[model samples]
Target chain A: MTDNNSGFSDTKQEIMQATYDAIQQHGYAGLTIQSIADNFGKSKAALHYHYDTKEDILAAFLNYLLSEFRETIQIDEDSSPEQQLLDLVDVLLYGPDNSSSEEIFQMQTALLEIQSQSPHKQLYRDQFTQIYHWLGNLFVEIINNGIAENVFRDVNAHLTAQHLLLIIVGGILNRHTTNSEMSPDQIREIVTAQFLPYLKK
Target chain B: MTDNNSGFSDTKQEIMQATYDAIQQHGYAGLTIQSIADNFGKSKAALHYHYDTKEDILAAFLNYLLSEFRETIQIDEDSSPEQQLLDLVDVLLYGPDNSSSEEIFQMQTALLEIQSQSPHKQLYRDQFTQIYHWLGNLFVEIINNGIAENVFRDVNAHLTAQHLLLIIVGGILNRHTTNSEMSPDQIREIVTAQFLPYLKK
Candidate 1:
């Protein structure tokens, strides 16, 4: 019975992977359950067995993404708070190092499309809220840790975190939405240089 | 002949107003040409007579919005650069003083939805690109003026402007996407306190 349950879990994981691939290829606007099934290498009937509608599968996909993001962004307690903060920003801005630029761009576009729908979709809004809260808490914790260690100046940790969150979120949106001329590396350098000085003692 | 031309311009402007009202009421997701026609107080045939399709109407609406934005955000040449900058940020964040909170929120939700569709729609993308460029240039000009007037530090005007733009755009997105506890006035105060000090010499 344990083995059967494990197999079932693996199939669900496969479905999530297929959904990601489908969104990347077709974009959220073009995405359909059939497209996800096509990516899954399964029949539409099989997909319908697990999810009744595209929104149902997409909602599950958001949960899957949040868990994956939580797993991936494991902050190192051993590292200095400053380094941890920079690393977190890097992850948010540049995404995974393994993914090609084209892949990252396509994924960002798909995510923005989903984000645009969040206002109308409660499932997406709930997941995004949770994600934002998780990120904000991480930032606050790091800032507080830095202050405690006497490595950073005294600052309103909550306010500072909100400021940083604004930049990070804005940077991600601007990348796809605006006709930005600066490369990602340029933006990272600018953000680091311009903002970090204010935090130092 | 001039009267006939003026009448033509008036009808187009009226159509744009109807589109705006429709989007605010139904949101971009639920918006249809018929809905716009309903707001227009005209038959669908009249709307079709003016524009062939929904996308065409929306494209024209985007242009109308851009022109209206340009007219609305007029920076006073006589004001201090610092005040000009703050006023611009206020306009972007809080919108016009006349609009109610609910109306502003609904308009933002609709705009974000349209922005999300930008990647797939060239017409929308072009308009957004133009809008961003216009906003960025305005920031750069104000920053440069501040530096020249000895009111601000000798910061890289281009980079500094980009940073400010990131915050502004991000703040707007966060208001709708995240479950932020901060009120608009609170955020305005926080942003002004945290970021402005860095610019002063």
Candidate 2:
């Protein structure tokens, strides 16, 4: 592996983007190196040369999404805790638009599918575990800050955080499984309008 | 197909039990007719006679679980809405013992795998949709009653119910993905002790 500027990393990003699109469209079971190759107009052998196996590609895909999640997570320090919370919900529930949200829903659904598998379960466990804790800690910080500022009532910061995560997580699962109609606005409305009231004075 | 008695139904139960054991052990991807056949002393041919294809068996397995879930859901009308909520949390998180909760975890894991597939999506959608509505409606009623009785904070019952579902759903996803130690008791405690306080008076 020769080190180079953006050339190798650029190919990697292209591979992952193709993967994300394929998985969203066809799912993990339906996905193959050939399918990913189809997106790039490359042969399956070319895909195999870049990545040895589907597992290798998937591992990279998971890493790609994790990096994206970390990069996009931004919270303004000076904002009210309530505003911060809404920001968190916005990041979790939607992206720039419906199209991005759809991609996210597909990404999450794909991850859950992989997470449930025994072989990948151990492999991906640590990364997701870090994510779980990071979010939990963020919620705890928000709650504690809110209490300190006296804008919200004193609630059990840890439990409240877990509760919020639960709803967000549950909402994510529901997006794929439920037959109900859910647009991006509906999800945001539920988060800010319905779920947020519990924390508000 | 001739109408039969308990004998046929009992055979159906046994087959589904085998399917459950196989899925819990091997996961949906690793699931095979042989794996299920291994559960009973029955051969693959015998299994095929009962189920034409692996899809048939999985479909049956899903239906069996759905019926079991409906049968077990019971509530005392006389109990306070708070008690009802706790009871709901308890049932969702765990059962009388760890084994049952473990089984529930496996069942959910299997369903999630099938759910990610394009073919099985429609078959499972109606059943899951009914379940989503049933649980949401249950939450709405409970919240409405709690506010009426002055036992809970005046929260938007519909949203609150959805939030509660979120925690439970998130917890389910966490059960498989997180490496954290969470027994049935710990999960129940988190729900009752940490998350429950916000709604109670």
Candidate 3:
């Protein structure tokens, strides 16, 4: 009998969720084993039994995020490639949208800091590279579809998709940190307007 | 007599330059007073005489970068606003190819880290806000010019410029981090191709 002993995977998920919550409230600098354990109603020793250090917890969380993203974008068997690509974008930019935005931002910030000093930085870098390549392939598919449908001009599909993916990510980063009086709706309108013309068929 | 004894203002500039070089070489995690002092051939005490801590050094470097960006994008008195806007985009996306791109990437990464914790994050945020508004104003000028010249379609200039900036930053960042064998030239060509049709006069 153990607090997290339903299963090993269950235990890990519990701790990860707790750590994510703490980070959302207090930022990465506020992430500590004691704080996490306190939030879990356990002692730091119990926390250590499962994960050795703060970095370990962060690595596990990063793995979860990457896996979720990859799974989110994986194509279904019967879906047209265009639909798959749109699904991928929606999953990336508009996930559950319930409890994830601040948590995702905090995780991004924390991982960036970890990547600064740890040998594990390569782990995250590899994850990003995989996502980037996947995005390139998705763009190539969408551009081809648009041209076959005669919605897009005869242009380099690879380059067009790459540029679009960049705008999506970079636009979100800019919008996330911006302090302008622009409402969220306004920002979305701007992003959609910029993106639709390129995506339209 | 003071060591080096360049006037106080020059001394400040020297320290800021040395600090930028040191921090850029060794990221914030490894940055130290000793490392910066060594860069300048001065004692740690001598370096601390100007700035109180490593954070101070980092902040000074950010200020230096902000000023350099401002200078490059400054609107000239004689040029039309349209020309000034075009020049600003050129300066931002394709500045002198002489400098190492790593330095620019490091500066951006460092700013993100420092901003997360610094009280002066607001100051940096304000600078970014100014950049956004300035870009918006430039787009407005372009739209007005195009309308007068009967060249452009009925598009919202401010919104279009905002999106263009997003895609441009995104493409540059993707090129910077990935191993896609894509060059800056290719990225810029794609950008010009996509936006030129929309900007016809």
Better of 1 and 2 by DockQ: 1
DockQ of 2: 0.52
Ranking by lDDT: 1, 2, 3
- Off-target runs (Cα >4 Å) in candidate 2 are A1-8, A38-50, A97-101, A118-120, A182-187, B1-8, B38-43, B96-105, B118-120, B144-148, B153-156, B182-190
Q: DockQ of each candidate's interface versus the true one? A: 0.66, 0.52, 0.37
In model 3, the clashing pairs are B151-B201
Best prediction by TM-score: 1
* TM-score per candidate for chain A alone: 0.90, 0.76, 0.65
The candidates, ranked best first by TM-score, are: 1, 2, 3
Model 3 residue B165 CA deviation in Å: 2.2
Candidate 3 residue-wise lDDT, A1-201, digit = tens: 123323337667677767766776666666788878877677899889988877677767666655555544556647664566556666555554454665555555554444333322555455455667876886787668767877666777877777667666556546544566543344456545655565555
Q: B1-201 in candidate 3: lDDT tens per residue?
A: 123332336777777777777878886666788888888888999988888877666656665655555444556647654455556666666563456666665664555545434322565555566656666676677666666656666677777776667766666545544455455566566556666555554
Write one digit per residue (lDDT tens) for candidate 1, span A1-201: 112222237778888889999988888888998899999899999999998988888888877877777767878899998899998988887786677787878877888878778777888877778888888899999999999999988999988888888887777787777556446776686568777777878
The candidate that wins on DockQ is: 1
Kindly give the stretch of ten consecutive residues in candidate 3 chain B with the minimal lDDT sum: B1-10
Candidate with the larger lDDT of 1 and 3? 1
True-structure lDDT of candidate 3:
0.61
Question: Interface-residue RMSD per candidate?
Answer: 1.3, 2.9, 4.3
Off by over 4 Å in 3: A1-8, A36-53, A70-91, A100-120, A135-143, A150-155, A181-184, B1-8, B40-50, B73-90, B101-120, B131-154, B172-183
